[model samples]
Target: MHPIIKIESLSKKYKDAELYSLNDFSLNINEGQIFGLLGPNGAGKTTLISMLCGLVKPTSGHFTIQELNYANHASKIKKIIGVVPQEYALYPTLTARENLHYFGSMYGLKGSHLKDKVVETLDLLGLLKFADKRIETFSGGMKRRVNLIAGILHNPKVLFLDEPTVGVDVQSKNAIIDYLKFLNQNGTTIIYTSHHLAEAEDFCTQIAIVDQGKIYAQGTPSSLIASTAEARNLEEVFISLTGKNLRDAI
Candidate 1:
């Protein structure tokens, strides 16, 4: 099977920045795998995702999504990728249903077909009862679920999620993970970034530990944990590789 996403000698440097956020990174993410990009804050995880999603241009290097080069086939690539941003991409003034309607319409979905999909996904994520309520009235978990539904209405082949469970309760996190697993099982390739090592260990089929804009270690969770001498879990392995230093950038 061909890799769903391929990054070749990828690097990026923002204007006025002292160093490159990503430095000569290269990786191949296989189709249908739950790939986790585990890193601390400012590890260039978001930068990499943004480039892959076509939201930002790389200063150098190139990538292919679904075997199509990003530079030439961006339009075709966009149709097959769903991006669930770290921030809530919902209208606080609108009801959940209304918000979903807008998101669905962006992908050219309309009428009863879009409405039915929105309702079904909302129901699946336990937000059906709250669909008619304004987003401002919803909890973080509810908003996260709704945000997820927004990205997936079009059923893209690849999904890019940034910290999908950052500030939610354990129950909500489980619900999100379960739904992601459901999508992955049905052939959606998932790439996500998060600080939740335990969750990533259980949720991801492949993992890459990134630091200082580079991949320090990468493999399956079990393989990563086993590879480190005296490492008990993903957290131990992470700390052992990344260290205890604080990355404070002005």
Candidate 2:
């Protein structure tokens, strides 16, 4: 299968940073696969995803999403990719339905089509009853689910999420994962970064372990688990590669 996203010699250095945020990174994500980016804090995972999403420009190198390079085809690329950042992207004053309607409009969806989609997704995520509630009144899990729906309402070919399940309850996490699985099953490729290893172990088809701005390892979760001597799970593999260092750099 062809990769939906390709990275080549990707590197990034912030203006005042002493070291590159990403160093010579390269990766390929196959279509329909859930690719996990696992790393310690300050390990460059977010920087890598930010570059791919065009939220941050790389200092050097390039990436292609569905054969379209950001340098020349960014507009085209944007049309087919969805992004869910760590922070909530909804307006606190708006109702859930209203918030989604605004987001869908940003993607050119409108009228009955957008309305139906918003209603359907809300119903699917078990939020139909709360559609008229202001976002400020919702729980963390509720906001997270709505945030996910905002990115996916356009039905993009690829989706990128950062710490998507953070600060959410178990039921909400399961709901988010189930919804993501539904999208992946229907042909959306997922690329995400998170410190949640046990969740990634079950959720990701492929995993990349990055540390100090480089990919230290990449493979299927089982392959990665078996490759290490006595490494039992994703967490063990992570610890083996990233060590116990406290990445407290400011």
Candidate 3:
């Protein structure tokens, strides 16, 4: 199968920055993959995702989503990809159903189709009973579930998620992971960034350890662990490759 996402020598550097955030990164993400991009703070994980999601422009290089180039087919590419950011992107005062409908409409979904999808997803995520509840009144886990539904109402072929399971309780984390797995099993290619190595080890079919805008290692979690000397888990492999220093950024 052809890669759903293809990047060739992709790089990104801010206008006023001294160094490149992402430098000559290239990789292919196959269809139906639960691909994890793992890294520490300021590792360019978010920068890469931002560029792919069209939230930022690449300083140089070429990349394509679903065979659609960002240069010529940006509009078309946007339709095929879903994004779930780390922060909540919902209206605080709006009811869950209202928020979903508004977001779905942005994707050109409307009428009974949009309404039905919103309700169906809410039900699937166990948020149906709270559909009419204001988003401000919902818990963090509940909001995350709703945020996920907003991005997926259009059923995007490739989903880009940043820190998806962060800040949630164990139960909420399990729920989110289960939903992602369900989506992946049903043919949605998932690309996500996370600090949760253990979760990524269990959830990702393949992983890439990125630092300073470059990939230090890329393979299945088990393979990475096996290849790293004295490493028994993803975290060990991560620290072995990325190191044991603080990656603090302002």
lDDT of each: 0.92, 0.94, 0.93
TM-score of 2: 0.98
Question: Would you estimate the TM-scores of all the predictions?
Answer: 0.98, 0.98, 0.98
- lDDT per residue for candidate 2 within 11-63, as digits (tens), equals 99999889999999999999999999999999999899889888899888888
- Overall local distance difference test of candidate 1: 0.92
Please tell me which predicted candidate would have the highest lDDT against the true structure.
2
| lDDT of candidate 1 over 20-72, digit per residue (tens) | 99999999999999999998888999899999988889998888988897668
lDDT of 3 at 241: 89
Superior candidate under lDDT, 2 versus 3 = 2
For model 1, the stretches where C-alpha displacement exceeds 4 angstroms are none
Cα-lDDT of candidate 3: 0.93
What's the residue-level lDDT of 116 in candidate 2?
Answer: 95
